[model samples]
Target chain A: MTKKQLKNLALQSYTKDLLDQKKVESVARLLTRFQLKQYIRELRNSESQKTINIVLPHLPAKTDQQMLSRLFAGKRIIYHVDKTLLLGIKIIDNDQVYDLNLKDTLDNLFTFVSSGYD
Target chain B: MIDSQKIIEQLENRLMSFGVDKKTQNMGVVEKITDGVVIASGLSKCFMGEIVAFGNGNYGTVLNLDEDTVSIILLGKEGKLKEGDGIKRTGKLLSIDVADTILGRVIDPLGSPLDARPKIKGARAMPLERIAAGVVEREPVNTPLKTGLKAIDAIIPIGRGQRELIIGDRGLGKTAIAIDTIINQRVSNDVICVYVAIGQKQSTIAQIIDRLKEEQALPYTVVVVASSSDPASLQYLAPYAGCAIAEYFMEKGKDALVIYDDLTKHAWAYRQLSLVLRRPAGREAYPGDIFYLHSRLLERAVKLNKKHKGGSITALPIIETQANDISAYIPTNVISITDGQIYLEPDLFYSGIRPAVNVGRSVSRVGGAAQTSAIKSVSGKLRLELAQYRELAVFAQFGSELDATTMALLERGKRTTEILKQLQYQPLKESLQILSIWSVTNGFLDDIPVESTQRFEKEYHEFVSSRNPKLLETLETGEKPSEPTVTQMEKITREFKKIFSF
Candidate 1:
C-alpha cells in the first residue's frame, strides 16, 4: 500500500520468522522497539495509496516463498522481466541493487568485436 | 685516603670490559679528595663532561667527563663521585633517531614530532650525516619549474629537477621566493614540497608557518626545522633529514621539491661537531669531508628514468653571501655543485626591486624548456631593455645628453623593477597583479604615470577579480595575453591613472 506499510510488514515478518526459527531470543532486545512500533503505526496509517513500479530483464531463480522470506529478512526488493536481460535476473531496491544477467556480461563484447573474433 | 693500587685496578678492569685499548688510554689523578676521584687527560679531550653509571643497572652517556687526571675521557655523573673515583671508558659515540614517518610532518632538530601528532609510522631511520647523491646516477635537469615570477620566469627560469642555489645577503627575499614556489605547487597535486630551515630564528620559522597556513600550503608541505637554538648535532642533521624524507616520495615516482632555507649554518654546525668529535680539520677549520658532505646531499636530488618511478627532487639551496661575495669558499663550493643560481643583488634590492634578482648574473641552467610562450616572448625584450637601462641610467646620472632611446630604456627599467617589487611574503596566486603590470609595461597602458603604479596594480586586480579570474591562471601558464584580457587590463590602468592623478 504505502512505502511505510511495506517497510513495517517486511520488518514484522522478518522478526516473526527469526522468532519462529529460534534465531533470536527476543526481537525487543535485538532492535529498537519504540522505533519499530512507530514505524508500524505510520505504515498502518499510510497504507492506502502508495505503490512502486520496477523493471527487470528476467525473473529470478528463487520461488515466491523464498522471495517473501528474503523480503521479510530486511531485503528491500523489486523485480520484472525483459528479454533484454537475456536469461539472467536483476533486482533493484532502496540503495541496494543486484544484477546477475547476460546483458551486463555482453557489454564488454565490443573489445572482442573489434578484434574480429567472437 | 684511598689506595692508588685499588683505584688503578678498578679503572683497568672497567676499561678492559668497555673495549678500550690501553695504548689509546692514558690516566692521571686529579685532587684525591675524600669525596671522589676527578681525572683529566689529553685522550679525554672530546669526551669531557660525559658521565657513565654502572653496577646499579642504569647506563647513561657521560655528560661531564673530566680529562685532567685520566688519559681517557672521564665518565661519571656530576654528584655521583665519592673519594676513590674509578674511571671507565665507553667507546660508543652518540647517535640520532631517523625514521620514515618523519616526512610530510614538521619536526624539531632532535627528530621529535612538532605537529603534536603521534610518532611517525615508518620504521627505518638513519643518522643525519648521510652521503650526497652520486654523480653517475643523477640525470641532468631538463624539466622546468615555473615560479610564476615574470622577471625570473622570463629571464632566469628554474627547471623542474634543477638544483638552483639562491644566494643573497640576509634580510633579502631568498626564503620568500622559495616559500612562494611552494605555494604555487598547491594547485598541482603532483608536486610535493619540503622546506628545511637550518639555523634560522624560531620566530621566523613561526612566521613562515603562519604564511603557509594563510595560503593553505601546509597540507602538501613538510617542514624540517633545525633552528639556531638547536644542538649542533641537530643543525648538522637538518638537511640530510630533509633529503631522506624527500627520498621516500621520490621512490614513489612522484615529483618533489625541497628547499634548504640556508646551508651555511648547517656547514658551520657540522664543522663544529666534527672538531668536537676529533675529526681532522681542513680549510677554514672545517672537516676534510666538507665538500663530500655537500656533494652527497645534492646528489640525492635526481629525476628518475621511466622504468623506475618517474620522480624528481628539485633542490633550492639558499646561501647567504657576506658583502655579496660569491667567491667565498662555501658559496663557490655550493655554486659548483648546483645546476645554476638565482643571484639577488643588495644594490638592486635597495633600489626598490623586491626580489632584487640580478638578471645579468643570475642564470637557470635548464629552465629554457619550462618557459611559457608568453614569458619567452616578453622576457627576450625585457632583459635587453633592462641591460641598456642600467648603462643609460648610469650615464643619465652623469649629466650627459640623453637620447629618446635611453629615456625609453630608463622608463622600461623602472617599470620592470616596479613589476617585480612584490610585497614580502605574499603568495604567488597574487601574480595576476604582476601580469597586469606586465601588460602596462608592454605599451598596453604606457600613459600611466610613475606614482600611479600601486594604485593601477590594485585596480587592475580588482577588475580581473570581478570579470574573468581564469585569465590569471592562463597568464601564469605563459599563454599570450588574450585580446579581451589585454583590453580589460588597459581600461582599468587608464581609469586608475585618471583617478590617482586627480
Candidate 2:
C-alpha cells in the first residue's frame, strides 16, 4: 500500500478525540509489522495534539481549573505545579512550549550575558 | 573599556520598559546518539543546514530529514547528551562572524577565538556555504599572484582569483610552498590571507602561526583551524569557514587569498559524517555528493568585475595523494575542479629539490597572460627549452656522443634547474626572479659551472643592486625592457663575468 494510504488509515483510527480500541485493532491487523509501528506513532501524535499541558508555580483553585477546561472546551487540559517556575505559567503543546515566568526570563538573560564572553 | 554610566542608564531604561513577548520555537527530542550525530524526532519543521541549539548550550546543524526523524551533526565536543534530550531550532543558518578584527586571529569553524585572544565583536555574519558569484558578476583573471618561486613564477604562473591545486605526496613541502606564498604577499600588501588548517596537528598549526608572526605576515592573515582532535563536523566546516572570511574582504573590494592546507582530510571527515548518518556511499565509501563538497567551495574563488567593486579571492587548495597516485577518487575530483595544479613529486623532493614542483606536469590554465611583461619577454621560451632538455637528458644518460647543439641545450638546462632550486622562506622579488631566469635563458650562464650557479645567481643580484640600482629599478617596473636596459644588462654581465671566479 502507498504511504499516503497508511497515513490516512492511522488518522482514521481515532474517534471523538481519542483512540477507538476496536478501530485500532482492525487497522493493526491490516498493516504489516513495520507499518503498524508508524501507524501507532501517528496515532499517538494525533492524540497528543488534543491535550495541552500547563505547568504553574502552584496549584490553581477549582474555579481556575474549570475556567481552563472551559477555554479548551473538548480538548484535554492537564495542570501541574513546580516551585522552580517562581511566578507565572508554562504551556507545553507536545514538542513546542509557551514559557512565561520569571525563572525562564532570568535564565534567558543569563545565557545572553554569558554568551557574550565566549 | 565599557562605559559605566551608559550601562547604568540602559539598565534603568530596560527596567522601566521591558516586556516579555511571545517567543515560539519548534523543538525536538533526541532519539539516538551516534558518535557526533544526533537523531531526533519531532523536528518536522526543521530545515536542512539550520542551526539547532541543545538545552545544555551545545549546537548542531540539521543534515538530513526523513519521514519520521532528522539527523543532525553536532558542531562541537559532545555535550554529554543522552536519548530523550531536547533541542530547539535557532532560526539561523550556519555562518561565521567576520570583520576586520578577524584578520591575524586564529579561530575555529564557529568563529570562536582559538588563540586565547579577546573575542571579536561587531562582526557581520557571513554564511559558511554561499552560492558562488555567477558568470555575469565575474571577470576573467588577468593579474599575477606570484609565489616568488622561480619555476612557478616563470613557468606555471597563478592568477588572482584562480583555483590552483597543490597536489603531492606527504612531507613534500606543499605547505611550505603555501606559506611562502602567504609570506610573499607581504611585498604587495594588497591581499588579505586566510589559512585554513583542517585535521592538522595543533603543534604544527601553532608552529605555522609562529612563523607567520615572525615574518610579520600574521598582521594580514587569518588562521582558521579545525584540528584533528576537533569533531568531524568542524573539520568538514573548516574550508568553508575560511572561504567565508575571505569572501568578506572580497565583497569589500579587497583582494583575498585562502589556502586550504589539505582537503584530503576534509573528504575523510565528510565521509565519516555521511556513514554515521547512514547515507549511501560510493567509491572509497565517500558520499555521492563528494565532488559537490569541493566544487561549491572552490567555485567561491572568483574575481568580481569592476561594477562589483573589482575584488577577487585567489584559492590555493592543497591535496595530499597516497604514494603519488593522482587518479585516486578525491584527488582526481579536485584536480578536475581546480583551474590547474602544481604537481609536487617525492622523487624530486628526495633528490634535494626543495619545493619539488614538477614543471612538466604542473600547469597554470591562466597561462602567461597572468605574468608581467618583463618576466614574459625573458622567460617566454623557458618552458619549451626545459621540456627539450629533459627529453635529451635521457638520451645523454646512455653516454653516446651527441651534436654540439644538444650539449649546449643540456648545459643551459642544468644551470636553469640549479638556479630554480630556492631555499625555504626565501622568496625573491619579481625583478630578481626575472634577472636569474634571464641570465640562464639568454645563454649568459652557459660557461658558468652548474655547481657555482647558485653562488653566481646570488652574487649577481647583489652586484646589480649595489652597482647599478637604477637598472634593477627599471626591471622592477614590470614593463618590457627598453633597448638601453638590454644594453646595460649585457655590459654589467660582461663586467661581472671578469670579476667573478668559479
Candidate 3:
C-alpha cells in the first residue's frame, strides 16, 4: 500500500475504535486498553529502523536469519512466501524494489536486449 | 532488395552476443511534478547537469541538487511522469550531436531534426557547457567582419572575433542587421554562420527561414530555433547549443560566426527556469547568475593563436530594449560583456534611415585595428565631418543666414547620411563601400544635391565596376588608392556628374 493509503486506513480504524469506546463501560475500558497497545505499536514502528519487506517462493528456515541480516544490515526484515515468485526473491525497500525473481528478471532481460535493436 | 531473414539472423546473433550484467543503480522517486520540473528524492549520487531518465523513458537534465531531492528540468514531453514514478541517473551531462551535415538544417536545442528532413548522420557529440579559450590561447582581433552596411562599415566596424551587441527597441531593424550580416557571408568563402532564434514567434522564424532560402544562404548557414512554444528549458539551452556547434567548426581551425537573435527572450526563459527551480531571485526577478550566463556564452567567441590554426568566432548578440532604456539590468550586463555596441534608434528608423545606426552611441572598440587601410583612410575624416555637421546643423537651423562653409558642411552631412542609408539584405562589397565613402570625403560629391547622393553613389559604383574593374580589384586586394587611381575615379565622377540631373 502507498503511504497515503496506509494513513487513510489508520484513520478509519481510529474512528472504529472511537465508536466502540461509547458502547458500554466495561467494553469501553477493554477498548481503551487495546487502543493503548495499538498506540505503543505505532510508536515502536515509527522509531524502529526502516523495514525491508521481502517476498520469496517459499519460507526459509530460521537458520537463514544471520545470513539475511548480514546482506541487509541495520534494516528490519519481514518475509512473505509468494508462490508466483517461482524461484527467487523480491525485496521492497522504502522507494526502490529489488526484483530478483525469475519471471521479472527474464522480463527485464528481454526488454534490455530488444530495446538495443530498436 | 533487402532480405528479412538475414536481418533477423543478424539480430538474433547480436542479442545472443549481448550479456546482461547485474549492476546496482541509484534510484529515486518523484516527489512532485510541476511545469516540466520534477522534484525527486533518493538521487543523492546524481551530479548537477546530469541527464536522468524517468519511468516512462523520457529524459531530464538535473539542475538543482538539494540535500535529499534533486530538481530536474524535463527535456521532452511531460506526459506519463507521475508523482511516485521511478527515476534513474544516466551519468551523463547534457550534450548534443554536431557535424558538418548540420549546415542548411533547422534543429531544436537537443539537435533533433526540426526541418522534417532525414536525420543527420556522422554527427559527433559535444557537451553543451564548455570552458572558453584562455587569454594565452587567443590573439588580438586584427581582421574585420563586415556587415555590408555602409554606416556600420565606416564607423562601427566589427572584428573577426569581437562580440558586438546590437541594442534597440523592437521594429528598429535589429534582426535586419543580423540577417544582412549573414547574407553578406555569402561573399566570404571560409566563414560558417549559425543563427540561434530564441523565444521568437513561430511565424517570425518561418519568415526568416523563407528569407534565408530566397537569398540562397542556407547552404553555409545553420538555423537553431527555440520558439515561444518550446519549453523554457529548451529556450535557455538554445544559445549554448548554437555556440557548441560553432565551436565544433572553430576546433577544426575554421572561421565561424554565431548570432543570438535577441537574448532578451533568452533571459526571460532563464528567469522562468530559475523561478520554477526555486532559485533565489535577484534584481528584476532574475537570478543572480544571469550575468554569468551571458558572459560565459559570449566569452566563447575568440580568435585562436597560430598554434591553434588561427580560427575565430565572431558573435553578434541582439538585445531589445524597452523605451530605449539601456540602463536596464539586462542591457547593461550585456553591454559590459561585449566589445562594443551598435545602438539602433527608432526615431532614426522612422526618419527613413533604414539602418538607423546612432553614430554617437554606436562604437566598436576592437574594430579599428582590424580595419582595411583603404577604408581607414577615408572613414576617419568622414566620421569627424559627420559629427561636426550634426553639431552645427542644429545651430544653423535657428537662423536662415549662414556662412558658405557652414552651408557646405550641412549639405555634406545631409548627403553623407543619405549615402549611408542602405537597403536590407543587399550587403555591399568592401570595395564598393570604400569607393562610395572615398568620393564623398574627397569633395567629389559636393556639387551633387543631397537628394541625388544615392543616385550618384549607384552610378559611380556601376561606372567604376564597368569602366575600371581593375581599381575595384586593387581595393579588394587591400591596396590603398594611389594618385593615378584617384585621378581615374575623379575623371569618371566628373563625367557622371555632368550626365546626372536632379
Candidate 4:
C-alpha cells in the first residue's frame, strides 16, 4: 500500500482520547514489516508533538516545576538533566532549541569577543 | 598597534549591556559520514552556504539540502565527528575576515594565517559567495590593467574589472605570465592584488611567494592558498575567498586584481564535493552546476559606478588545459564567461617564444578601450605586420621562392616576433612598450638583422633612457603621439641606426 494510505490506516486506529489496542493490532497485521516500522515511527512523532522537553543542569524545585507545568498546560512536560549546560534551562520544542543555558551564553560571549578582538 | 584603551571601553559597554536570554538554534543530528561528507537530518531551517557549527572550532558549510537530509563537506582538519554528534546552525554565511593588514600574508580559505603570522586584526567579514554587483551598480570597463607584456598590452589587453582567462597546456609559462602581471602592479597603478592558489603543490606556491617577495611585490599582494593537501571544501572556497578579500579593498574605493591561478583544479574540487554528496553527476562526471560554479565566481568581477564606490576587481583566471585542447568542457565554459582570453600555445612556447601569446587567437572583447592612447596609436600596424608574417612564415616553411614585397613582409614579421618575445619577469613600462613597437612597425627595425634585433632593442632603450628622458616622460602622459614627437622618434631611430654596428 502507498504510504499515504498507510498513514490514513494508522490514523483511523486511534480512538478519541487514546489508541484502540485491538484496532491498532488489526491494522498492524495488514502492513508489511517495512510499512509497520514506518507506521510506528509516524505514531511516535505525532505523540512526541504533544510534549515539550526541558533540559537543565539539575532537577528543578517544586515551585519551578509548578511554574513550568502551568506555562505549558495540557501538554506533557519531560525534564532531562544534562550537566554540560552548567546552569539555566533549555526548552526543546520539536527541532528548535530555546537555549538559555550558561554554556551557550559563555560560548556566545567568547564568539563575540574573539570575532571582534582577535 | 592596537587601540587597547578604546577596546577596553567597548568591552565594558558590552559587559554592562550583557543579559542572559534564550537564543534559538535549529539543530540536526549527524546520520552518517560518507567520504568526509556529513549527512544530517532535521536542520530544516538551514540555508545553503550557511555554516554549521560542530563545536570545538570545527565547522562545515551546507552544500546540499534534500527533502530529508542535508550534506555538508567538513571544512578543516578536525574530522573525528561521531554518527550521533549534533550540529547546530550558526545563522552565519561563509565569509573571510579581511583587513588592510592582510596584505603580504599567506592565508587559507578560512582566512586563517598560514604564514606563521598573527591573525587578521579588527577586520570586517566579507561573504565569500556574494551576489555580484548588478547591472545598475556597474560601469563599463574603461581603465587599463596593464600586464606590461608587450603582446598582451598591444593585443589581448585586460581592463580594470575585466575577466581575462590565461589558458594553455602544462609548462608553457601560464603562471609566469600571471606572476609577471602581479609584479607589474608594483611599477604602476598601485592596484592591490590577491592570488588564489588552488590545488597547487606547496613547494610551487612557496617558490611563487619567494619570487613575489624577492621582487618586493608581496607587500601589495595577498596569497590565499588551498593547496592540494587540504580538503576539497577549502579548495572549492579558495577562489571565492580571494575574491572576497579583493572585494574588501575595492569596497574601500581601491582598485584590486584577483588571479585564480588555474581554475581547472577548482572544478575538480567541486566535482569531488558533489560526487561525495551523492549529487547526480552530469557531463564527464561533473555535477550539473559545473558551469555555474565558475560563472558565479567570475561574474563577481565588476567595475562599480561612482554613485557607489568607483572601485573595481579585475579577474585573471588561469586554466590549464590538457594537450592544448581549448574545446574541452571547462575551457569553453570559462572562455565564454570571460571578456576574452590570452591563448598561449605550446607550439609557440616550445619554439622559444617566451610568454608565447598567440595573438591571432587571443582577443580582448574590451579591446583598445583599456589600452592607453600611446600604445593604441602604434599597436595597429604591429598587429597587421605580425599577422602577415605569421601567414607568410608558413609558406616560407614550404621553401618556395617569394617576391620583394613578400620578402619585406617576412622580414618585418621576424623582427616583430623578436620584439614581442619577452623573457620571464621583465615586463616593460607602457611608453617603452610603445616606443619598441612603433620603431618596428614604422620600418625603422627592417634593416636590423633578426639575430641582432634584441640587442638593437636593448641599446635603443638605454639610448633613450640615458639621453631623452623628456620624450618618455611625454609618452607616459598617455597622449597620442604628436607630429613633432613622431618626427623626433624617426630622427632618433635614424641616428641610432647609423651609429650602431651589426
**Which candidate has the top score in TM-score?**
2
Which pairs of residues clash in candidate 2, taking residues 3 or more apart in a chain or in different chains?
A: none
A-chain TM-score, model 3:
0.49
- Model 4 whole-model lDDT (C-alpha atoms): 0.89
TM-score of 2: 0.92
TM-score for all models, in order of appearance: 0.62, 0.92, 0.86, 0.90
Model 4 residue B278 CA deviation (Å) reads 2.1
Chain A vs. true chain A, TM-score per model, equals 0.36, 0.85, 0.49, 0.75
DockQ of each candidate relative to the true complex: 0.00, 0.39, 0.16, 0.50
Candidate 3, residues A10-93: lDDT per residue as tens digits?
A: 344433323223333333354356554444333333322257778888987777867887888867788998988788887766
Give the alpha carbon lDDT tens digit for every residue of B361-455 in model 2: 99899988889999999777788788998899899999999999999999988888888899998899998998888888888999999999999
Model 4 lDDT tens row, B72-168: 8888864678887888898889999899999999999999999998899878999999889999999999999988899999878899999999999
Query: Taking the tens digit of each residue's C-alpha lDDT, what string does model 1 give over B364-436?
Result: 7775575656566556666776787677778878888787877777776776666656675554442473465
The interface RMSD value for candidate 1 stands at 39.8
Give one digit per residue, the lDDT tens place, for model 3 in B110-164.
Answer: 9888999866667888899999999999999998888889899889989889999
lDDT of 4 at B186: 87
| Superior candidate under TM-score, 1 versus 3 | 3
Give the winner by TM-score: 1 or 4: 4
- Rank all candidate structures by their DockQ, best first, as comma-separated numbers: 4, 2, 3, 1
Off by over 4 Å in 4: A1-51, A61-76, A82-87, A110-118, B1-22
Candidate 4's TM-score: 0.90
- What is candidate 1's CA lDDT for residue A84? 86
Q: What is the interface RMSD of each candidate, in Å?
A: 39.8, 3.5, 3.5, 2.6
Displacement of residue B463 (Cα, Å) in model 4 is: 1.8
